[model samples]
Target chain A: MSLDYLTALIAAVLFAAAPLILAALGETISERAGVINLSLDGTVLFAAMVAFAAARATDNPWLGLAAGGLAGAGIAAVLGVFGLLLGASELAVGFVLTLFCRELAYFMGHGQARQPGPDLGALNLPFLSDLPLFGPAIFRQSPVVLLSLVAVGLVWFFLMRTRAGLVVRAVGEAPAAAVARGLAVTRTQFLCCLAGGALGGLAGGLYSLSVKPGWGHPQGCEGAGWIALAIVIFGGWKPVRVALGALFFAAIQVAGIALQDVLPGLSGTLFQIAPFPVMILTLLVVNLRRSAAFREAARRVPLLGRLVPRTAGGAPGAIVGALDKGF
Target chain B: MTGRTSSLARAGFSLALALCVTLAIVAAAGAPPLTTLAVMLDGGLGSGQAVLRTLSALVPLLLCGAALCVTFAANLWNIGVEGQITLGAVCCVWFLRDLGLAGLVPPFLAVPGALAASMVGGAAWALLSGVLRTHGRVHEIFSGLGLNFVAMGVSLWLILGPWKRPGMASMSGTEPLPAALWLPALGGRPMSLWGLILAVAAFVLVAWVLNRTFFGLTLSAVRQNAMAAERLGLRPKRRMLAAMALGGALAGLAGGVLVAGLYHRLIPSISGNYGYTAIMAVLLASGSLRFLPLACLFFAVLTVGSIQLPLALSLDSSLAGVVQGVLVLTLFAARRLWPAGNTGSTGGTRNRGSAA
Candidate 1:
């Protein structure tokens, strides 16, 4: 393949990765603080519908993005109350909440099926505009991509350098330790979960206002939330790494689509099944106790590296500090 | 939730509030106002045929709900009842497809064989999830969920592939089953004797296992306090799998009966998300096996009311899903106020306690 092929590949990867990037980043924050919200799937559908409706009403794509994020956060806030304060199990509450939110979106979005949302126009960077096929695909998308990168930086800084982020991590790693050290465990968890919710909402906005705009069906959002969840596990609870995992997942997804073009003989349904099997396989092989090579590779694979660190002494500050530098 | 009194009044209040909220939604959908709800009540409970239809729907829901109760009691969250139902339907269809054998075996013999196949299929399907949870360290909730999707995929492939009736989709199913394999109608009634017989037998068996047997006691112990149960030599893994397997088998049997007694051939939409709906029923009843029959009646009424909207007001049929969602949310909210009575042994009080 030529450099042009490389350009096309990167562009496709970015296009595919954007939603996963936003969703997984949100989930990373949520899970990092020891809260697992399975509601991302439902949150995505509702937010997509909300953003679509908002964009149609105002004809302002930016408002749609805001609406989607708010919609996503609205569901997340419900989860926060039950999980943080009511002391409900995160798994059950999150799963059930997701089901309710998805149904709510389906019920409400019934009428808006015909009217497509306003699409956010493309943004082309001045210097990067001339980089062949990759330039337009990579640089000339909506501002969501740029914002995702910025959010990654901000989240990385917040989680590692900031005192509040430290408290969030403390709560996740050991709630008892955070409580002993004067951290309000519930409050930190609430903050992380809600932030994750907002980002999840933003991911929905990116879909409705950018990719597949105005596409309204019963389940048009279709499995993106589960993909986001998979990305988190793939990234192992780190923002930048989650982004990389998003890219990897995006690549597999894009490949499934791209393969249909080259090999029409192979059933696309079978190809579509490939990623899930790959995911199941990857997960099966993960978390080994005594494999040194697996441990080393896992620690160096950027997002996956977050799972197993390579520090010899295992010092807390030093390890987190090393993670901080890596990001 | 434990050590707190005052749950009865709270649960009662929440249920009423939820029902009222549902009434309001129906009104907004341009159905007749709150007063017209009486018409719905009359329609659901008034006419003999309407009542019979509601009972027909109730029969399967009752069986499924009872089956669900067992799993929920053990905290096992078996959401794949729909698939088990589908698989059971397939097994029944399998036996019926053999035209020569169908003539040889009498209806009584064939019916039991079909029921047995269904129960076994359902049990094995559920047992796979149980095995994964017990040995593979995977969470049962997600694994069960994944199996639900897998089951759907298999169902679609079967219907669209091998089981695809020549005019099925055009007519929407296989050629209707021959009368020989059909579930026998009750004495001088339109309802199936099998429906009543199977439902009653199941209720008796579940109640006996849950309330009478040592295994029943052990299962509750496993649910209430897994570690303490283990300390007392009750293997939680085995208890949970048994509970789920039992739940799965009954759900599957319900699926078979639904096919033989009602639809007779497998269609893709046979599930109607009933397995998931059973979750609402199980939760609403607080997994009390005794209350499941009543919960099924309430759900049957709820289903009739929701179904009336499409013909009566052009409302989408998915209104039932939203209503069930509302029911589940209310149930949890009710627990917040009332403190789940049976759940006293659960929660932070027993950090070692678990649901399946």
Candidate 2:
């Protein structure tokens, strides 16, 4: 590929990764707080529909985004109310909400389907857009892309550097200890779920208002949430790593599109679903590193020991423990 | 209140709430609620043909619901059941076309061969997720979801590329199988008595195994406390895998029935969201075999009935899903409001497991 084309493709990948970055980071916050907000896939679709409809009605993309964020937060609130306060299973509630919100979005947004709406376009940074490569790919993009980049740094800083982040981590680690520390455990988790949900919703809004653009049934962002969820595991739940994971996934997606032309004989649907199996394989590899036999083999061989990175991170202790307890 | 009475109260309350909310939604959407109901009734069960359609739809719902009961009993979320059904259908088509065709297999044996292939396909698919859950340290939900997409991709590839209909590549699905390979249907109707018998028999057999068999008790033991079950010499992981395989086989049967009895071809949406819809029904049933069949029938009605909403009321057919979701959510809310007492409760009383 030519340099200009390569630069453009790089920029496009960055743009495509924007929504996933937001959603994954959002999920990272929630999971870090020991809540699995599995309603993400439905939340994205619902948010996309709401964002598109609101933007069309008000003719303001920002309002559309805010509306989408609210839509996401609302779903999270339902999950929290059922899963946390009422002591229902998070997986059940989240799974039900995912399917429910999807059909509800389609049902309610039927009228708004295929309607034209205002889209958020790229804001060209005068000097940056003219830069050799990095400028166009990084700076000369929509605000949502910039927001996603900012989100990585911001989430990392919030989780690692802040006192509140410490409290969140502490609560996630041990709910009883958090209670002893006078940290409102449920409240903290609820707030984190809401925040994560808002981010997921914004990601959806970005899809409709910027990334994919326009509203329709079978919205292009249907399976994006599940992929984001997988990316979280692939990234080991670190903000920066998760952002990188999103970018990597986006690159795969872009490559799929590019490969469609090169291998015209293959079906397009095959290209579309290529990343799902890749995600599963990555999850298997990531998890396999922690398995007993893998660790044993790694220990027996000096070279293998060096090759296998020390298992620094797995699921949060409380999430794993609680889920295992089936409570 | 006794657990049984409280359960009945919750069910009734949830039903009332679901009805109120659905009617309100229909009225708000500017369609007369009563008219919508009547229209859906007419569409789903107004005549012999419509009843046949509903019954055909019921076969998958019952089978998928039965599949879910097994997995849910073991506390495994087999969300990949949707993909299992798709794989099953693909396998059925593959068997019928490749082996059963060109006089390789007799017509009488072809249908049975396709069914067996579908069962194996589904069981293998579920086992993959089960293995991932037990050994790979991957959560079944994520693995299941990922496999679901991959299964869709595989089916799509088969339909559009290798299995495309003669002279045309289309999203409409693959070529229809020969008549001899099809499940024997009621005279001139699409509904098959054999499919109905298989679905109902499978459900009843599952219910018996779950309620009476030692294997079912062990599964319950594992679900209740896997650590304790393990200490008691029960192999929790193996039981979980067994549950998943059994569930996958039944789900695969549903797929086979879809191809042989209903559609006679592998379509893009062959599963028709039945797996997820079955999940909702199973949730409402809340581990009780008694309510599960009713839940499946209720959902089957809503699904088949909602088909004519666009034509009759200019409303989206997805209203069926909205209603089902509301009903389940209301049940959850009701259970929260009125927690069942310690006595006279079955598996439904547990707040420890994943679902209602």
Highest-lDDT candidate:
2
After superposition, candidate 2 runs with Cα above 4 Å error: A321-327, B27-31, B341-356
lDDT of 2 by residue, B83-146 (tens): 9999899899998889887668888899998999999999999999999889887778888888
Top candidate by TM-score: 2
TM-score of 2: 0.96
- For A150-186, candidate 2 gives per-residue lDDT tens digits of 8899999999999999988877767777787788888
The reply for model 1, stretches above 4 Å from the true place, is A1-10, A132-134, A142-150, A215-217, A259-282, A287-327, B1-5, B20-46, B98-107, B167-171, B185-193, B231-233, B338-356
CA-based DockQ, model 2: 0.48
User: TM-score, each model?
Assistant: 0.84, 0.96
Docking class of 2: acceptable
Model 1 Cα lDDT, one tens digit per residue, A1-327: 887787778777787678779888898888777777788988888898888888888889899889999988888998888766766556556766776767666656766766745888788898786878767666777666667777889989998899888887877766666677787877877888899998998888888777667745554455678768766765657778779888887799789888889988554445544554455334334423113665677666867665553433111221121111100
The lDDT, on a scale of 0 to 1, for candidate 1 is 0.70
